[model samples]
Target: MTADTDATDAGAAATDVTEPGATPTATDTTVTPATSAHPGPDAAAPAARSGRRRRVGGGLAVVPLLAFVALAFGIPALAMLDGAFTVKDPVTGASSYGVANVTASVQGAYLTALIGSVKLSAFSAAIGVVCGLLLAQAVVTSRSRVLREAVLTASGVLANFGGVPLAFAFVATLGNSGFLTRRLDLTDKGWSLYSFSGLTLAYLYFLIPLMVLTITPALEGLRTQWREAARNNGATNAQYWRHVALPVLAPSLLGGFVLLFGSAFAAYATAAAMVGSSIPLVTLQIADALAGNVLVGQENVALALSLDMVLVAGLVMAVYLPLQRRSARWLA
Candidate 1:
C-alpha cells in the first residue's frame, strides 16, 4: 500500500513538471484570453462623435462673420440692385421697373467718366506697383531696423490718411497761389493741382504706401535659398530677378495692382474736393447724381452707377483671387 501511494505521488509530480521537447498536457496548459488588434465598432463611435462635435464648434465660430457680411454688404447690394432697376418720372411721380437707369448710366458723360476712371486707376496702380515694390525691396534689404520701422509706420499712417484732409494738404502745398506752386512756378510749367495728372499725383501719395504694405510680406516671403541656388547656377543679378525673383513675385505684384486699382477707383472725397468735375470719374458722377449737383431726379442713375462700380470691383476680385491662391502656395 505504501509503495502504491509513493508511485501515485511520483506520477503527480511528473505531471506538474514540464520536460524539454515534451507536449504539454491539459493539466499543465494555461488558457490566456484572446485579444483583437483592431478596435471594435463600439470603441470607434465615441471618436467619430468627438470629431463631429469639433467640426460643429468650428462652424459655429464663423456664424458671426457671416451674419455681419449679410447685414452690411448683402443688404446694401440688394438695395442698390433694386434701385438700379427702378425708374421714376419727375413730373408724373410714376415708377416703372426697367433698365432705363442702367442704360443711361452707361451712355454719354457717364461712359466718359467710366473710361476716365479706368485709365486713371490703371495708370496710378501701375506706377504705384513699381514704386512701392522698389521701396519695399529697399526696406527689406536695409540693415537698419529703425529705418524699416519708421518707413512701415509712416506707410501705415499715410495709407489711412486721405479724404478731405489729404485733399486740403495737397491743395495747401500744390494748389494755385500755394507755397510750392508759386515758388516752383508749376503753373507756368503746365502743372495744375486740379487736373487729372495732379489727381494722379495725389492718389500716388496713398497708393504707393498701400502697395508697400501689400507687397512687403510677399517680398519677405522670397527665400534666401532661392537666391543662393540661382547664384550657384551661374545667374547674374538681372537674370536672377528675371528668372527667379520676378516669376515668383508676379502673382503678388498683380494682386497688389488690383488692390491699388480698387482703392483709386472708389475714391471720392479727395477727388471731389480737389478737382470737382474737371476729371470725369464714376465716383464723381455718382455723387453728382445723388446730390442733384448736375441734374435732379437722377438718383436712380446714381444707384445704377454704383451697381456698375460694384460689377467692376467684382471683376477685379475675380482676377485678384486666383493670383492670391497661386501665390499662397509659394508664400505659405
Candidate 2:
C-alpha cells in the first residue's frame, strides 16, 4: 500500500504516532472549536454555571424567607384573623364563623385595653423622645471625653436593659418599700412603680435610650456647614433649630415615636410581672385566654385576643399611615 503523508489531509491525523509503522488518521471532519486556545465550551462552562448558580442561590433566599413567614407568621396571623369573627360552639366544640362573634363584651374589653395601651404608650413615647433628644444633643455636643464615653456606655447598657429586670429595678428604686422611699420618709406618698403610671415611667427608662440611639444618627447627619451658615447669617440658636434642624429631624422623631408606641403597646412581660392578674393588658389577656378558661375555650379566646391585638396595632399603624406614605424611607 502506498502511504500518503499529508498533515492537511482530513484522514491524516497524527504526525507522531506511538506505534511503530502505524499512522492514525483524523476523522472525515475538521475540529475547529475543541482546540481553540481562547475559550472552548468547557472552559466557559464553569463561569456560565457559576452565573446560573448565583441566580438560583439568590432566588432560593426568598423561598426560605417566604416559607418561614408563611409557616410561622402568616399561618398564625390568618388563624388569628379568622378567630376574631369566629366563635366556638359550646356544645359541639365547632367554630361558628360570624361577625356577631365579636360580641359587645369582647368589643368593650378590646376598646378599653386599646385606649389604656395607647394612652400609656403615647405618654411614654413623648417623654422618651424629648429626654432622648436632649440627652443625645448633650452627648453629641459634649467636649468632655469622659462624659461622652460615659454617655455612650450608659446608653448602650440602658438601651438593652428593659422589660422584667427593668421593672424590678424600678420596684427596688421607687416602689413603696424602695430604698429612696425609706430614705425620704415618703412612705405615705411613695412612688408606685407597679401601677399604670409607674409602668409608663419604666417604659420611658428604656425607650429614652432607644430614641437617643436612633435619633443620634439623624442628629449627626446634620451638616456643620448648615449650622455655620445660619450663624454667619446672624440667626439665633432657636431660629436655626426652627428653620433647619426641626424640619430635618421632625420626621425621624415622629417615626421614632410611632416605633416606640408599637413597642410599648405590645409589651407583656414588664406589664404582666408588675401587676400580674391585677392589670389587664392586651398581651396579658391573650396569655390568659391561651390558658383555656372553663368559661372561654382556649382556642376561641386566644383567637379573639389575637384579633384584638391586630386591631389595636392596626389603629396605631393607621395613625402613622400619613407619615408612612410621606417619608417612608426616612421612617424605615
Candidate 3:
C-alpha cells in the first residue's frame, strides 16, 4: 500500500513537469529553425507583394518629372546636335549631314568671339569669387541676427536680379546722360557703358551676391571645434585659416567659381541689351545667325555655337559636381 501511494505521487509530479500550456523557461526560449526561417508562404507573399507595390508606386511618382525633362531638355539638345551637323545644299536646296557648320564655328570670326567669351567669363568669375568669399566670411562671423538676415535677404534679391531689367537699371544709373554718369562725369574719364569692361562691371552687380549666397552656407558648415583645436595647438588666425579652414573651403570655392564662370558664359539678355553687336559675344553671334543677320538659311551655324556653349557649360558643371560632392562629405 505504501509503494502504490509513492507511485501515484511520482506520476502526479511528472504530469506537473510536462504541463501542456505552461510558460516557457530560459532554456526553452531559444528560436527553432522552423520559426527563424519564415512565417510560412501566406505571410511572406503578402509582405513581398506590398514591398514591390511600394517600389512601383515610387517609380510612378517620378514619371512626370522624367517626361518633362525629356521634352524640355533632351529633345531640344538632340535637335541642336542634329542641326549642328547638317547643312543646306545651295544647288539642290536639300539638307544634308556634314561638319561644315562645326568647322565654320571653330575658325576665324566665330573662333575670336568664342575666345573673347571665355576671357570675359574667366575675368568676371575670378573677381566674383574673391569679393563673394570676403562678403560671405564677414556675414558668417557677425554676431547681429538682424544684420545677418538683412545681408542674406539683400543677397537673395541681388543674385537673381539679372536679365534685361538689370541692363536697364545699370543704364539708368550709369548711361551717358544718366544719374551717376552725369553727377560724376564718368564719360569724361573715358568710361563707356557699351564696352566689355562695362559689361563685366554690370555682371559683378549680380555675381558678387550670388557668390555671397553660395559661400555663406559653406562658411557656416565649418566646425567650431576645428578653430578651437587649432588655437589649442598654438596656431594664429592666419595659420588656422590656411591649414584648417581653406583646405576644407577649397572645394566649395572652386565649385562656386565654376558656377560663376558658367553663369557669365551663358548670359544673354544683359549682354544683348547693353552691348548688342558692339561686343562680339558668342550669344550675340548666335542671335545674329538665328535672325538671318549673318547667314540666312544657315541657322546651323547658330546651332553649332549653341552646342559649343553647351559643351563648355557641361565641362564646368562636371568639375563643379565632383567638388560639390567632396565638400558635402566634409560638411555632412
Best by TM-score: 1
**What is the descending lDDT order?**
1, 3, 2
Relative to the unseen true structure, what is the Cα RMSD of model 2?
A: 10.0
Better of 2 and 3 by lDDT: 3
Mark the regions of model 1 whose C-alpha exceeds 4 Å error after superposition. 1-31
Q: Which stretches of candidate 2 lie over 4 Å from their true place?
A: 1-57, 104-106, 292-295, 318-332
Give the candidates in order of TM-score, highest first: 1, 3, 2
Local accuracy of candidate 1 as per-residue lDDT tens digits, 98-163: 999999989999999998999999999999999999999999999999999999999999999899
Q: 9 in model 1: Cα distance from truth in Å?
A: 5.6
Q: Candidate 1 or 2, higher lDDT?
A: 1
Query: How far is each candidate from the true structure, as Cα RMSD in Å?
Result: 2.5, 10.0, 4.1
Q: Give the Cα-based TM-score of candidate 3 against the true structure.
A: 0.88
Stretch of 10 with least lDDT, candidate 1: 319-328
